[model samples]
Target: MKPLKIAMMSMTHGHTRKYYQTLKDNPKLDWVAVSTANDEVKEIFLNSVDGIPCYNSELEMLDAHPEIEAVVLASENSEHLRQMKLCAERGIHILSMKIPTFDMDEYEEMIDIVDKNDLVCQVELEMHYNPVIVRMKELLANNEIGKIKSFNATNITLSPVWAFPWQGVPEKSYGKRVHVKEGDPRFRGGALCDHPHIFDMIRHMTGSDFDCIYAEVAPNIRPDIIEEDMLSVIGRMKDGTIFSLDPSWSKMEERLKVPGPGWEVFPKRMEVNITLNGEKGTVMADCFGPNVYHNGCPNDRYTVQYTYFDEWIGLIDEFVDNIRNKKQPLINLKWHKRTIEAMNAVYESIATGKVVKL
Candidate 1:
């Protein structure tokens, strides 16, 4: 298959740094250009960047690299729509960050634009590609554990505000400034917006749709932001599988600009641990754990060093296959709508203090 001529937009996202190696090393992609949100981000992007041409404006980058076939929209939440429109207008395929947009109408517009352009639009929920998760899916499909009565998943991670400040802003991170309730100062976009993998995963695991969602917020670890740093949601899938999710920025951090070592005040920067209760048996898995440990460096504390990082390889490979072979990706826009809808239901549940129906 021919390699995809790819580009990345907005270097300010938390996942921007993670994609650098994947974009450059993947045999299926040719990372052609990058456009940052501002001069500060541009300087940060260029200072350590290797060969890719870093542009100050998307127009300039697109004009210079007209052959660029695909793009990874690594922008802030609010910038997704504008950047997506630009990519769609150019007929470029997209790999959007997890939360595309909170507004349903705007989200629908994005879908329409991409479909009209006949482009592949895949969302980034890297947990879908994790090997441990791949194993879990295989096990569940095989019914190694009988009917799942309840599932609990935790996607807790250190706050990215220090690294990606835009995430801490209500308007920038949540797509708008939304009051959760009459007296609640914290807006709708916060830790919940940052973590949607568990929500999305439940749908995949149970092969069901969202039924209703109930959410509650906790006291913020960092009180400076308008977004909540902690949240919990309990819901039932249409298939009758009950689930609970803890999508909080509960881990501690050292305020590093880039996501790297010594970046976490806690030993592990992130955790995606899950537990399931079933009729036949039960299982617990840590998708990103049981990893290599290290006690070296700036902090001599023992750390679970990550060894597996091929999610982008699988994701990009799928995109390439979709383009080259004319097959739809597993996480395409159409397939991901339910996940987005489920996420929205959580917010609605929070606002009304009642279970939101799908």
Candidate 2:
């Protein structure tokens, strides 16, 4: 297979840094230039990576590297539509961040752009590519756990606001500053916006669409931020599988400008754990665990040094395959539409304090 020449844009998302090593090392890719959100982001990118030229704007990077075939849209949620439009206009394939936009209209516009351009746009739900998840899917396919009756998952992480300030802004993270509920100071974008994996994952596991959802938000751990920091969701799938999900920033972290050692105040900085009760048996899986631990660092605090399974490898590989083979990704815009709708319904449930039927 011919290697795809790729670049990255708006190096501002929390997951942007995670892609550096994968882009560099992937033999299927020819890692090209990048466009940063600002000079500070450029400096940070320069400090961490070398050789790849960084541009001040997306147009400048694209203009300079006209051979680029694809890009990783590692940008704020608000910037997704604009960036997608730019890339689609250029006939460039895109690997978009998790939450493309909370607004359904803009989401439809994004779909239109990709469909019209004949582009391969993959949503980055990296959990789908994790080895544990792959195994879990296999076991379910083999009926090792029989018919799934209940599904529970947690996609918890320390708040990334300190490292990526836009995450704390409701307008940027959620694409608007709508209140999460009437008379609530908190806005609609927070932990829920950051963690869409479980929302998407449950659908894949149950082979069912969402039937109804109920959600509630707890008091923010960091009340200074207008967006929510902690929340829980419970719902039933169309196939009658009951599910409870916690996609909260319940894990605490140090207020670091850059993510690095000692950033985690909690021993484990992030977790994606799943538990399923089936007709025959039960299965529990930790998607990100059994990691190495340490008490030596800048702060000497015990922390989890995540030895991740590098989900990006498979993710990027699939993106490349989709673009090269004229095939749709597993998490394409159309297939992921219901997942996004389900997430939007979660916020609606939080707002009304009632179960939302989807």
Candidate 3:
């Protein structure tokens, strides 16, 4: 079989570096060019890694590697549409960031572009590939939860905007700034904008759409931001399963650019703990760990050092397989719309101060 050639664009994202080892190590993929959003991010990429040529611009990189078949849009969430369109027009398949364009109309346009080009557009929700989550999925599907009547999930983490500046920007992260409610100091973007995983995961687990969603915010822990840092959403699934999800930036982190030992001030820097209450029993899961403890170099605080944390490996494998074999990706456009819809409901709920039907 021919190897699938893939490139990565906009190396400014927090997950950008995480993909490096996975891309190079994947046997089926020929990792190619990398383009940064600007000269600054380009210089940072230049200084950090090896075995990959980092280009200052996409056109320059694509001009060099015309054989490139796919690209990972590892840019800020705001850059997704423009970057994907560039790849789509070139007949290159895309692996997009977690949050695509918040505008439903633009998202629909993305589907149309892929349809017109017969291209793959897979949104990266990496938790789907986690081993623990995979096991959790299997057990839940095997009636371990005994009919999910409700789901409560948390995709809580520190605000990465300190390192990835775009996330803190209302215009870039949220696409637009709208108030959550009257007299609300916080804007509609921020942490809520950062997380759509649990929202999407609930859809995946139950195979049901959200019936309604309501959201409320608490004052941000950090000052000088138009976006929210704390919030919660409660809703009902299409199957009448009541659910609640907290995708807040509730955890505290040491201000670090390159993630390291002391990065997390909290015990867990990131978490995707799920709680499923069913007719017969309940299932609680932590996709990241049951990790071993550590207090060695970098930071002296005892930490639940994670044993397995790479989700990009499996995600890239699937991307390669879909490209080489001409199969649809698991997180394709049509499948992700409802997740976006559910997220929009949170914005709508905060807007109207009432439950938004999904």
Candidate 4:
């Protein structure tokens, strides 16, 4: 297949930096121009990348590079719908960040817009493409652990709010500024908004939708930010599999303006580990692990230097195939709606202080 001409918009997402290498290295994609949220972000992007045109606005970038066929919407959660609408209007294929929108009606509008444009809008759920996750799925399919009785997973990471300020804003991260619950000072957006992979992963593992979810919010680790940084969720799946998930920003950081070597105060920084309790046996897997360790350079603290895998390569490959072959992606807007719904239910459960039935 011919390389798809692709550009990235709003270089503000935490995952935006992760895509730089993939966009440049992937033979299936022609890395084109980029549009940043502002001059500051543009400078940040330009400092690292070379020989690529950077613009202040999407329209300016699009006008200059009309040949651009697809875009990676690496913006805040609130910016997704507007950006999606703009892309849809131009009939451009989209690779949206994980949380498209928190509002269900807006999400439905996104689905309609994409459908109407006959465009491939693939959500970036990179965990689906992780090698460890692929192998885990294979084990589950082969019944290596027999029938799953309980699914427990942790998607914990250091907060990116220091580097990406939008994540710390309630309206920007959660698509609204509503309080998390009655009398709670913190708002709806935080770690839960950042981590949706475990919620989506359980569905693929168990072939079940969320039955009910109970969630509780802990005091903010970064009390300066109005968004909740720590939370826990326990839920059940439609297939009778119970689950406990921790998608918290429990790991501490150095409050760096730009993410780099010394960003982590915690050694591992990020972890997505899964444990399955089955009738026959139990299985434990670490999604991003088996790494090299070092306590040198910027910080003398011991840190897990990750031997990063190219999950984005597989993800972009599927996006390209979906566009070229006119086929739907595995993690398309329609297929991912339930996952989004489940995430919203987590917020509802937190607000009501009761189990939310799905």
RMSD of each: 1.4, 0.9, 1.4, 0.9
Candidate 3 C-alpha lDDT tens digits along 1-358: 6778889998888788888788878888888879889877777777767878888889999999999999999888778888878998799999998888888888998999999999988889898999877887898889976889999999999888778888888778888877778878667768988888998889888888889898888778877667888898898998999998999999888888656678877767888899989988998998887888877767787776878878998998888888777889898888988898888888888878898876
TM-score of each: 0.96, 0.99, 0.96, 0.99
User: What's the C-alpha lDDT at position 252 in model 3?
Assistant: 86
Candidate ranking (lDDT, best to worst): 4, 2, 1, 3
lDDT of 2 by residue, 1-358 (tens): 8899999999999999889989999999999899999988889999999999999999999999999999999999999999999998899999999998889999899999999999999999999889999999999999998999999999999999999999998899988888999999889889999999998999999999999999999999988889999999998999999999999999999999999888889988999999999999999999987899889968888888888869998999899999999999999988888988999999999999999999
- Specify the poorest-scoring 10-residue window by lDDT in model 4: 308-317
lDDT by candidate, in order shown:
0.86, 0.93, 0.85, 0.93
- Reference-based lDDT, residue 208, model 2: 94
Candidate 1 achieves a global lDDT of 0.86
Query: Residues 224-323, candidate 4, lDDT per residue (tens digit)?
Result: 9899999999989999999999999999999999999988898989999999999989999999989999999898999998997689989988999999
What local lDDT does model 1 show for residue 232? Answer: 89
| Residue pairs in collision within model 3 | none
> Which residue pairs collide in model 4, if any?
none
| Model 1 TM | 0.96
State the weakest 10-residue window (summed lDDT) of model 2. Answer: 300-309
Please give the distance, in angstroms, between residue 188's alpha carbon in candidate 3 and its true position after superposition: 2.2
- Segments of candidate 1 deviating more than 4 angstroms: none
